[model samples]
Target chain A: MRLGMFFREALRSIRANAAISVAATVTALIAVFILGAFIPSFMYVRSAVSAQTSKVDVDVYISDTASVKQVNALRDKIGTLKTDGQVAEFTYVSKDDALRLMRERLRDPSVLDELPSNPLPAKFNIQPTDPANANAIVAAVKDDAALDPTEGIVYPQTTADRLLTAAKFVQWAGFALIGILLVAAVLLIGNTIRLSIFARRREVEVMRLVGATNWFIRWPFMIEGVICGLVGAVVAVAMLWGIKVGVVDAWASGADTALTKTGSAGGAIAFPLLTVVLVGAGALLGAVGSGITLRRFLRI
Target chain B: MARIDDDIHDAGSTPRAFTLVEVPLETVPADLAVVTPPASEKRRRGDVFRPGPGPMVQFQGVIKRYDGDVRGLDGVSVSIAAGEFVFLVGQSGSGKSTFIRLCIRELRATSGHVIIGGRDLGELKRSKVPYLRRAIGCVFQDFRLLPDRTASENVAYALQVTGHSRQEVNRRVPEILALVGLDGKGDRLPRELSGGEQQRVSIARALVNQPRLLIADEPTGNLDPDTSQGIMDLLTRINRTGTTVLVATHDRDTVDRMQQRVIALHKGRIVRDAEGGYNEDPGDTGEIA
Candidate 1:
């Protein structure tokens, strides 16, 4: 028999079972949607992790009574921090500058002028090369007698701890959600294509009896499964992009200060590539699911 | 229409074995098995395409069974000449269907070689089964025509299954349909036709490829005497076309009346072989056609 004729017959069989095809498509759509929902959640979590990580720094307050030579020695250490692999940034503020900043923050314009001989101390602001070690770097600075009670050290320890916890939570949660969606997506398309194969088992058996090749029988279903998955992914991406742009952005721009306080709450969803990955992945996942179902039940 | 033989008449038939009378018609399953050709008369139509001989169908000491232990055909063998017509008759479950199925490679012989047209059916690859079947036209008693397809479609399907292009299939299907007396019924589906017509459609399917060997399994077992005569006439006409015919049936009327080579089988062994008088016209000897 003609290869073209057999494929045409297969296409006709698939068409005749319109209800099954639609059911499979709907199943694919839902499977892909569930998978797509997890994509942006992962991106948002990643973004949160990065934003929180960027806030970590080490602060070193110098004593006003320190010798000029000692202060200059510490300045040299701060300057070589990058090459030494100890710090990311170093900012130094003199006693006069510190008093002026405190005066401004204290919101008493006359406080700096009233201070006797600039009571505030000079300080070196240090940021670690890695956010993870910011607290350790601060502790090290404070352990030094001259940098301890005399000058003091400051670090955003509480905020860093909280942000690290949030980041870890997001990472684990996103990973766990992705794993579940993968299986669910496979099973979703698997059952759908299984029914598709079941619907055409008669034709399949006929073709088998007639000596048609296994690939000749299976390629169409594989193709159909992939196409169905792509459609599902496309729908999901559109929905995700719409939620990201039309709704989230509009809300962010419209006096949503409270929403913005969650560290650019809506900005984390800009991931265009991630959406493509999710959609493209859905198609691949569909192919794999089809492979399983066809292999298992199509008995090819 | 092309004129066929003169002896295919109702009164010219012979005794039929295991008719509907024997098999209770009170109520059978929906899938009524219309197995026509009985598998008696072991004629090993000699080696086909021998480097020095004409084509033949040959079987050498063939044994067959289902469970590999229960004997189907027990060490039986025979040779049949090319272009000869023969009939096989035996009791129910006497390995008639098994014999033909073995020749077609639908079932393999346990201990023998079945060779046809220079190709060994036993040794042919699984993929080559269709190609092998192309040279052999098989007609079932139940008329295994696709019920959903029209008469021409049913005939065309046989060719289509053998890789005939649309042009060749369209041409040969009509010719064969006409040959089977289904000329104008090409558009009629199997169910739309009478039982005899359905069997004729099957015959048309069998004849579509212009096969060298026509294996009919009770081609008319389902029809009444009159209708059965029509079917026998069709097969005889097919046999006259220089094609070897192997018919397995218990309808002694069609076989004895026709006076073709009769190979009688009793419990899987040949009991009778009437030959040489094959071409003697029934009219000259007062015998059935």
Candidate 2:
């Protein structure tokens, strides 16, 4: 029953102070909208970069004359590296399997048939825990006794290095942008709430004189703030959903651009969950903003 | 001062009533005769000061010094028992407002003590000020009504903010409004009402809580003579019901005509305390009596 009174008071204040409420809501919307758009885009970029880095690996070849026991020993060493948290995993490809993979890649099987016998070397494709750690894994097993002398180990160092660098830059830039946007949103919304409370400070003083507790006076203003925040977030989420459907989806499918191709290959974004988080964040910001701004006025 | 003591004869044997009863000012047990005790007789720091019986308001050598060393109240000692209608007469800077503010605990005394209803305000916790204010109804000159709320809503607000049930609020709001002579006008907003009607609404709001003390700071400052008279009469009627009413005003004609106990202040010090008009001695200098 008391909650009903608080809601009624809050609704009345909002209606009476419609301009301030709108200002606060718009401020929240701008902040939440920017955040909603940035989150999925950031996730999509990170996933695409991760997909690229996953292709990095060190290939260790076995000599044609190496004994089965020698190959087993190499596999055991790779297993030890995995257990030590250096190697992610390793796949052993026999010469026959390598030859069959090449035939599948060639335009004509006749080209491979002309070889008379398989010349492809059997190798263990060892994935590293981090793409940046490829060089360390390569150096660790490059001179192993069981490996072929001519093709002992091979890894695409330049590609892995470039991908890792770009990923690091993107991650840092994303964090900085998000931090700036959040601070801006909080300040703008808090200022709006402060102005609204300031305008009604006389009413608050009268309430205090008439025996209203600090919380009694605060609950209505807080409810008004939460309403403003929720409205802003709902509108921002709708706009984000529109952008996802009308802009993001169409741009990704309209061309074979690097961003669109990778985004599509990485799978769909979790927009429903992201919207919930954005909405929750907006409401929390509103509540905290009003709660803090009211402290100075409640000193009576 | 001796004349005030002679005028206020002992009527302490009368029983106190919790609700409003229309008794005349003469029957109010004129307890203003209890003069401030000397320094040696005053309660010490560790002692609790509940005046002889129970004065609704007491200020013992209360000194309120603001920043930059200006004194809002300087060594003002006064005691007002329950159910006394007293006029705090003073010019703009005479500290009448400061006294009222101190009574409500809006400002603490820089030194000495302000006791209300046997409670020493200096020792009252900050969190407990609301409850202290709740027992002391306040009416201002501006009729501080929320612009958006109707007369009834404005009055109900007092009860509502204190967590009273809606039914109790519904029952008490109209009763207080009718008592303050705002009966059928409860639906009107402050803008729709006259200056007099607005003050009536303010009074209703202040009295709805049924506080033991009612402090009106220039309640009639904004009203014309006739309207001010009506407001003062309503206050007097409220006081007759056993609530202590302290009106801080410089309204000469009403103060003279009412002939209530007048505590006149000048330069933050009381220069006159008697049962008389606004200026019993107009030529008296602004010095502590």
Candidate 3:
């Protein structure tokens, strides 16, 4: 029953002090919106980088002079070198299969047809358990005597490194932005609560004289703060959902955009999870910000 | 009742269980017949009354010093028994406000102890201040009513904060408002009420909790002589119910007419303490009516 009264009081105060309430809510909305916008984009970049890195593998090309027995021996040797499950799996591609894959990938059959014969070599694709360990596995394979007849080993080192660096930068920048925005949101809410408390200072004094407990005086203001935060967060989430459906989905359907590709590959956090996070953050900020600001006024 | 008093004194080592009783209502003077008979009976049996051994308020060598060596109260000692109506009269800056503030624990004395209802203000913790304040009702010169709240809400707020049920608050608010003669004005905001009506609402708010002590600071400073008389009469009625009433005022005429115990202060010191009027001038009768 007391909680119900507190809620009624909070609602009434919010309605009565519209200016401060709106200022706090709008500030919270902008902060949460900025946070919501950055989080998914950051997640998308990180996931895309990880997906690309996972595709990194060493392709060992076999020379035409190499014997079938030698190739088989190399395969057995590579299988034996799988210590602690460092190498995940391996597959063998024949010359004809490689030529077929090239033709399919290039989408141009004329170039392949002009060749006198299939100059493509059979290759063994080695998958490492961790993309970070791919280079080490490649070195081990190259140093082995049985793989002496290999033509070359290819791994997209430079591209993977660049993508990982970019992902790291995005992660740092996202956290920094979120930290700054959270401080701004807290300050805005605190200032708004301070103004409301100042306006009702006489009432607070009366409450004190009446033997009201400190929590009794504080709970209503805290509830009001939470309402402001909840409203702001709800609006921010609605805007984010609208943008995702209207702008992002439309652009993705019309043209193959990076965001669309990331969305397909589960590059960002789930929508429901993001909603919970934003809402929870909003409530926490409001409760804590106002709770701390009310300390000075409650001294009366 | 004697056993309870004995237990309280023996339980002094365990402060949590110690309870102070107020003065009995039978001690009220016979001439103050304004106290309703039923109310006095209720107070006699009600949980609100707890008769104790000491005075309602005791100031022992109290001294208050502000910054730059300014004295608010200098070596002033006084005691007010329960159920007594006393007037605190002095010029501005003569420690009238300081005396009231000290009783409510709003400001600590620079030296000496202030005991109210057998509890020392100096020993009270910050967390326990609210409990201390709940035992005392306070009124101000400005009436301090919330501008947005109706008079009923202003009065109900006193009960609500002390954890009274909604039904009890609803029942008691109107009763107190009626006692203060604000029967139908409970719905009016502070701005709508006259200054006298607003002060009465404030008084009702203060009295709603049935506090043992009521301290009014310049309650009649803003009212005309007639309205001030009405407020004083209401206060006297409250006092007759066994609540110790203390009024700090600059009104000479009310002090002279009421003939209550008057304590005069000058430069933070008690210049006079007698049962008469504002000043202890020659040829002024000191007899109570």
Candidate 4:
């Protein structure tokens, strides 16, 4: 009977304050939709940043004290051992070839021409199995007696570290924005429910005078709040879905495909999923916020 | 101040000391008005303060002030017995409503105690207030029924608040509405019902809980004389059923015709509390005299 009474009252409040309930729902849906859409983008950006930071092209230089026959033998041996985890690829780089490649990259044509009789060393351009395996690859090479220790191996560690920090920043920023949005959700819900409850102060006072428990009075308002939040979430999700589809399919025209390999698939469904999350988030937030306000203002 | 303080000192020296009701503005003080039996003040040494047991509710040296601590019930002492129908009659600013407020735990007396059912209400714990409320029903002038709900819903609301089950609410609600002659009008809203019917609905809500005491603060304040008579008749019926009914009104005819106890408050003091004033004609009940 008590449960029925609460439900009946809750339904009455919702029906009575139709406009206010709609307003609350819309706010929640939009907030949740936005949060949902960004979550995918945030995750994608972090992963892309991670990939960039973790991959590198590496090269190991072999010295002249090592004879051609010995160096060549070592190269051939290391090339076959690539499947064993040390080397991703092993190929010989002749002094002349190295100079030529340097001229192409550096645009220093004069330096390449003045490479005194193949001054550039014969290098084994070795790509490690993984970027993280660079140091291990270097150590494995060092254990060999044939390699020169002076300029044994090199990988751009500093660039990788910077990229990692940038990825972390993107992830954290996404999370921070999500936190702010949730707070906004609660505030929106609180104001809406407060207005609805305020409209029927006499009704609430009468309830209190009758010895109604605090929650008995609060249940209907909280239920209405949750419904509002969910409705808003659904609408927001639809809007977000439209945005995602429109941008990728319609707006993506004349856009650089060379820029995005994954296309809208990168964050297409995330918006709809985001809407779902927003709805859930909105409902939870609305329920809690309404509870607090109702508890204070309504004596029961 | 000097004369009053001197009287207080002298009264304090006596054994039957009836001092002021002392408490905060929120806690309803128990005040017993020491009524002299016409010969006791001149004869007895200790019986000066004790008015002798007469009723359950008495205002003893009670005072009430609103803003700037102005007194509302000052040194008021009157005894109202259980099952007594008392009419609190006074003019505007006569502290009639203040007396009711004190009686129902709405406002506390500034000095003296306001006792109810042998409980010194000033000393009752705050959490137990709702429990105390369960024992007393309050009916207001505006017919404070929830407008959005139907008549039965409003009456059922009273029991539901006390966590009554479906069967109990269903059983008691109809019985109460029937008692107020609103038996079949349970599904109608307040606006749908007439003014008299609406007041009856309010009465139905008040009586649904079966409170030991019924306090109607101007129950028919908004009704015509004919309608007012109807409400009075309902009260008389309830009183006949053994519940003490304290009605606050400036209605002379209603008080006069009932042959009930009348307590008149002038400024904050009880100027009269007696069996008189009801034997007059049953005319002009709504006109403030």
TM-score of chain B in each prediction: 0.75, 0.82, 0.81, 0.76
**Quick one: best TM-score, which candidate?**
3
Q: Show pairs that collide, candidate 3.
A: B21-B50, B21-B51, B21-B52, B22-B50, B22-B51
* lDDT score of residue B176 within candidate 2: 73
Better of 1 and 2 by lDDT: 2
Off by over 4 Å in 1: A1-7, A50-72, A84-86, A92-125, A128-145, A149-202, A205-300, B1-93, B97-116, B121-123, B133-149, B152-165, B206-210, B213-225, B242-289
Candidate 4 lDDT tens digits, A1-300: 556677777777888888887777777776777677777667767666666664665667777688877786767667665868767776778777887787888955786666457666777777667666666666666555456568666667677567767878987898898889778878777887788889887887776665454566778788888778777777777776777677745755656664354323443344445555666786798797688778667541
Q: How well is each residue in B1-289 modelled by candidate 3, as lDDT tens digits? A: 1333232224222111111233245543343332122221222111132335579999999999988888999999999997789999887878899999998888999999888887677876676677667668899999988889999999988877766778877777887788788888999999999999999999988887667789999999999999999999889877867678999998999999999999988778888888987764323333211
Q: Which candidate number has the best DockQ?
A: 2
Whichever of 1 and 3 has more lDDT, that candidate is 3
Stretches of model 4 off by over 4 angstroms after superposition: A56-158, A241-276, B1-79, B91-129, B266-271, B278-289
Ranking of all predicted structures according to lDDT, beginning with the best and ending with the worst? 2, 3, 4, 1
- Per-residue lDDT for B1-289 in model 4, tens only? 1222222123222322112123123222222111101122232111111112346576777778787856677788777776678888776567888887776666776778887766666765444445556557788889898988899999888877766667767766776777677768899999999888999998888776666578898888889999999999888767655567899887777787877788877666677777878343223334232
| Clash number for each model | 19, 1, 5, 29
Regions more than 4 Å wrong, model 2: A59-125, A129-136, A144-179, A253-257, A260-269, B1-18, B21-53, B280-289
After superposition on all CA atoms, what RMSD does each candidate show versus the true structure? 12.9, 8.7, 6.2, 12.9
Q: Model 1: how far is A132 from its true place, Å? A: 6.7
Candidate with the greatest lDDT versus the true structure: 2
Q: Decide which is better by TM-score, 2 or 4.
A: 2
Candidate 4, residue B12: how far the Cα is off, in Å: 44
Model 4, residue B49: C-alpha shift (Å): 32
Each prediction's TM-score versus the true structure: 0.65, 0.81, 0.84, 0.71
Listed models, DockQ each: 0.12, 0.59, 0.57, 0.28
